[model samples]
Target: MNEADFAALRGAILALPYVRMLGFDIAREDGVLRGQLPFAERLIGNPLVPALHGGVVAALLHFTAAAQVMREARMARLPRVFTCTIEYLASPDLRDSYASASIVTRTRRFANVRVSAWQPHSGKTIAAATMQFLTGQMD
Candidate 1:
C-alpha cells in the first residue's frame, strides 16, 4: 500500500449504501483497516441473547476481506468475491463490533483473505471468515 490514499479509501467505504445503512465506521490508519458496526435495533438478531445478526457480521467480514485484497493486490477494481466461508466463534453482543482483515494468498489472478471480528474488551473472537476472489489481472 505504498502512497496509499487512506482518506479516499475510507471515504469510498463509508460512501457505500450498505455501509451507511449499517452505520459502519471504517478507517485505514497505520496500515490497518479497522471497522466498527455501531449498535442499532435493526441489527439485533436475538433479544434474549442480544446479539448482532449473523448476516451483519458476515457483511463486515466479506467487505473487509475484499477491501484488503483490493488494496494489497493493487487491482484496478475490487476483486469479485466468489466464495466466502464464515465461522461464527461466538455471538457478538448488542454493542459496537469490530473487525480486521489480512491477505492470505495472492497470485496473478486470484486472492484469498482472512478476516476476524470481535467486540471491544471482549478479548475473544466473535467470528472469522475466509474469502476467495477473482482479481482478473495477471502479474
Candidate 2:
C-alpha cells in the first residue's frame, strides 16, 4: 500500500477507543498496511521483571497481520482476525518497539500472514505470529 492507503487505514484505527488507548501510531510502511504499538512509558520492561505483556504483544501481531490482508486485498474494508497465535521469542526492552507483517500466502477463501515485533535497540524479537484471515466475500 502507498502512503495514502496507509493514511486511510491509520485514520480508521486511530478512531477506535481501544487502539487510541494503546497509544499506537503507524511507525513504518511495508505497503498499504503498517505496524503500530503502544509506546507509552508503562510499556517498558525490565530484564528480570515483568516485560511487555504477552497479550499486548499478541495484539500488535494480530493487528499487523490483519492490516496486511486488508491492504493487499484492496477490498475497501478492514479484515477481522479469525484466529492468531503468537510465539514469544524474547522480551522487548524499554524502547519503542518495531513491528512488520506480510502476506505469506493467499487462496480464494483464506489468507496467511506472518508478523513480527522486536526491540530495535536490542534487536531482540519480542514476538512472532502467523495468522489466518478470512477476507469475506468480495462480490
Candidate 3:
C-alpha cells in the first residue's frame, strides 16, 4: 500500500471507539502490522489473579487481524468478522501487551487471519486466535 493509504488505515483504526477506550496504538514495521494495548486498570478482570481480562485480549487479537486484512488487502472498509476462536495460553500481567497478525488465506469473499499476542516478549505467546472475515472487493 502507499503511504497515504497506510495513514488512512491507521486513522481509521484509532478512531474505533473500543480501540480508543482500550488505548490501543497501531504501527507498521517492515510491512507487518502491530498493535499495543497499554496497561489500564479497567482491563483487569480478575482481581485475585490481577491478570488482564480475557475479553480484552480477545478484542486485541480480533482488531489486530482485522487491521491486518484492511492494510494488506488495501480494502477501503473494514471487513465483517465472520468468526473467531481465541486460545488463552497464559495470563497476562499488568503491563503493556502487543499483538501481530498474519493473513493465512485471502479469497474474493473471505480472509483468514492468525494472530498472536504477548506481553514483555513476542517469543512468548499469551493468547492466539484464528479469525475469518468477510471481505469486499478492494477499492
Candidate 4:
C-alpha cells in the first residue's frame, strides 16, 4: 500500500472509540499490516491469571483484518464486517501483543481474511480468526 492509503487507514482506525480505548497502534512494516496492543491494566480479563482479555485479542484480529482489506484492496471506504470467527489457542500474557492479517479471497463485493494474533511467535499464536467483510463496492 501507498503512504496516503496507509495514512487514511490509520486515521479511520484511530477514529474508532473502542480501538482508541484499546490503545491499538497500527502500522505497515515489511509489506505486512500489523497491529500492536499495548499492555494496559484495563485489558486484563483474568486477574488471577493476569492474562489479556480474550475480547481484546478478538478485536485486534478484527481490526487487523479490516485494515488489511482496506489497504490491500484499496477500498473507497471502510468495509462492513459480515462475520468473524475466532479460535483461542492460548492465553496471552500481560504484555504487548501483535496481530497480522492476510486476504484469503477477494471479489467485487466481499472479502475473506485470515488473521493471527501472537505475543512473540506465530507458533505460539494466542488466537486466530477468519473474517468476511462486505466491501460495498464493485470491482
Candidate 5:
C-alpha cells in the first residue's frame, strides 16, 4: 500500500468504535501495511510477566493481513477470514506494538496473507501469522 491508500484505510478503520477505544493505528512505510497497538492496562493478560494478551497480538496480525488484502484487491466490502494460524515467537512487553503484512498470493476469490508483529524492533518479531481469506463472493 502507498501513502494515500494507507491514509484512507487507516482513517476508515480507525474510526471504528472498538478500534478507536483500543487505540489501534495503521501506518504505511516503504509500501508496507503496518498496524500498531498502544498498550493499555486492560490489554495485559499476564501481569507477572507484564505480557500483552495473545489475543491482542493476534488481532494486530489479523487486521494487518486483512488490510493488505483489501488494498490489493480493491474490494468494495471487507474480505472474510477463512483461516488464520498464528505463531507466538515470544511474549510481548507492556508497551507499544507493531506489525506488518503482505499478500503472499491471490486469486479472484481467495487471498493468502502473511503477517509479523514486534514490539521494539522489526527483526525481533514476537508473533507471526499466515491467513487465508475469501476475497470474492461478498454478495
Candidate 6:
C-alpha cells in the first residue's frame, strides 16, 4: 500500500475500542511492526502462582501477528487469527515489556507470524508465539 493507504489502515487499528482498551500501541514502517504491551497490573504475576493470564498473553500475541500480516499484505482490512500456539519461557514481571512481530510465511489465504515478548531488565524472552491469520479478500 501507498503512504496514504497505510496511514489510513494504521489509524483504523488505533480506533478500535478493544485495542485502545488494552492499551496496545502498534506501529509499522518498512514491513516491521513494533508494539508495546501496557504494564497493567493485570499482566503481572507471582511466578509461583498464576500471575499472568494465559488469555491475556494470547491476546497480545494475536494482535502482534495481525499487525505483521497487515503490514506485509498492505491491505485495508485487519487479518484475523485462525490459530496460534504459545510457549511461555518465563513469566514476565511487572516491568514494561516490548515485542516485535514478523512474518514467517504467507500463502494466498493465510499468513504465519512469530511474536516474541521480552522484558527490558532481564533481556529474556518471556513468551514466544506462532500465529496463523486468515487473510480474507480486501476491498
TM-scores, each model vs. reference = 0.87, 0.82, 0.92, 0.92, 0.88, 0.81
Per-residue CA lDDT of model 1 for 28-124, tens digit only, reads 6787877778889999878788789999999888777777776776654446887888999997888788889988888877888889999877888
3-116: candidate 4 lDDT, tens digit per residue: 887788899888888999999979878978898899899999999998888899988898888888988777655689998889999989888899999999998889999999
Query: What global local distance difference test value does model 3 have?
Result: 0.88
Residue pairs with backbone overlap in model 2: 1-31, 1-32
In model 2, the runs with Cα more than 4 Å from the true position are 27-33, 44-48
RMSD of each: 2.4, 2.9, 2.5, 2.2, 2.1, 3.2
Across residues 45-129, which tens digit of lDDT does each residue of candidate 5 receive?
8899889989888888887787788788986445789998999998888889998888899998899998999987535789999
TM accuracy, model 2? 0.82
- Looking at candidate 2, what is the lDDT of residue 106? 85
Off by over 4 Å in 6: 1-6, 28-31, 44-50, 137-139
Tell me how far candidate 6 lies from the true structure as C-alpha RMSD in angstroms: 3.2
Deviation from native of the Cα of residue 93 in model 2, angstroms: 1.8
Q: CA lDDT of each candidate?
A: 0.80, 0.71, 0.88, 0.88, 0.83, 0.74
Clashes per prediction?
A: 0, 2, 0, 0, 0, 0
Error of 2 at 91 (Å): 1.7
- The global Cα lDDT (0 to 1) of model 2 is 0.71
Q: Write the per-residue lDDT of candidate 3 for residues 37-103, one digit (tens) a residue.
A: 9999999989899899999999889888888999877776668999898999998988899999999
Per-residue lDDT tens digits for candidate 6, residues 1-139, read: 5667667766867777877776777765565677776777756445567456566666667777776787788766678778888998887766666678888888888888889887789879888898888886544
Candidate 6 yields a Cα-based lDDT of 0.74
lDDT of 4 at 101: 92
